[model samples]
Target: MITAPGGRTLDLANLRCVFTLQGWTTSQWGSAVFKIYNLSDDTANAIQAGEFSSIQLIAGYQNNSGILFDGKIRYSSRSLENKTDQVVTIQAVDSHDAKVYATINQTLGKGYDAARVDAALMQTFEPYGVTRGRTAKMPGTKYPRSKAMFGRSTVYQDLLAKQCRFLWQFINGQYVSIFEDASLDDVIVLNGRTGLLGVPTQTIGGGAVIRCLINPTIQWRSLVQVELQSATTGYFIVNSINCQGDTMGDDWYMDLNCTAHNNLVDKPHKDSSKN
Candidate 1:
């Protein structure tokens, strides 16, 4: 079961839910989508429409020892199957996106590396509870540049990370440390012990795709090792994730779509004049 955050203070016994989450590091992959389903409560009304709220979801499989997806809920929806069954659907951008947009105005000085730029962005985000590990490689000597803040933090962070060979995202409302390439090492070892659900199959992303039981331990950009005794046994970076489960019934799993360490997407080039 996954924990849902809201004003109502929900418990496992009182909720029913399912969700598919998509997270990304490259521009082509786009924003995170957390499509959530929930039964309408007789009293609480958790899925009301308004930009005044955010949700933190901690998802995992039946044992509750893993992290399927860890992030925020920024958008939502609802529908009816007759009057007795209702599913509240929610669409959320990654917390990193929300943080960048919510961060009103700030300016990074004329000279700073990508790592330093991330530090400045974190200043605006520290209060929101960020999650991340150590620095990956902040390669490229594009150490000094002039960037003035005209709008959202997303605009600025994207430009800086790309030029310096890095990318960032927010996990469960906190920032996961930016990395040049996250799949090079294995952070989570996946096999029969950790719910290895399939062998490598050809998927849309060109790299091999694997799905496993859901848990809250793995976050976007974290490394995972698939130790199956085949061509699939190797390290990979988490490209995307989908956390699906229902608390009202006995069904749940987390799907991880990853890119090999050597295949992480490149950040797009930004026109310096545009910034």
Candidate 2:
């Protein structure tokens, strides 16, 4: 679905769309690419003219459908295919990407703790349209006087995550941080009945790579229960997901890279103020 100018929603049957949504558990920004075909001239012009603001990709069966990608359009272009069909391709990044390179130059006073610093940062990001989502408990580290924060916001976020021994990323439009070994409560069960495509394969690092029919319930940092072969049956933490789908093609599926839950080892904690 696309939100064009004037708040109009576009989802025509003649419009064919293929998208790739990539997610990661690190501080890197998640991104999406959408190729829409057979759009009307007006719609194509609107998109190419930078009149479209946001796009959403939803998948799964009727009652189980959910958002697969939601982001602001960063670029759009129109091209002719076979000299007959007009296609528009859009590239987008999650909300956090908009502010990843934003500069932050603030000074904290003495006795400011981790919680207070986090709150101040969130307040700064609010004006940029990023809201705080679930975040792990920050370490109990207090800053001394003249704690200067400078440079890109993402760099600070990465430093903070490393200091706390956690991972942080943006999903949809919200910022989230979580411990490496912790998992979301909602566990998606994957099996023959639930659209598991083939036997999962193990990576050299003991992680698993799997493919399945598009399921929106599967997301980054979430847990999935593999119920196929005995050797591969266990809970896994999703590290990354690549969702590929085409309305007019047989390419609707999700490829996930996951680590076995039991194989995850928490990193040793470090002093937050050392950096």
Name the candidate that leads on lDDT. 2
Per-candidate Cα lDDT values, in order, are 0.54, 0.77
How much lDDT does candidate 2 score? 0.77
Q: In model 2, where do residues sit more than 4 Å from their true spots?
A: 4-9, 12-14, 144-146, 229-232, 263-275
lDDT for 235 in candidate 1 is 65
Tens-digit lDDT track of model 2 for 106-135: 888898876666666666667666878888
TM-score against truth, every candidate:
0.68, 0.87
Q: What is the lDDT of residue 187 in candidate 2?
A: 71
Predicted structure 2, TM vs. truth: 0.87
lDDT of 1 at 107: 61
| Candidate 1: residue 127 lDDT (0-100) | 56
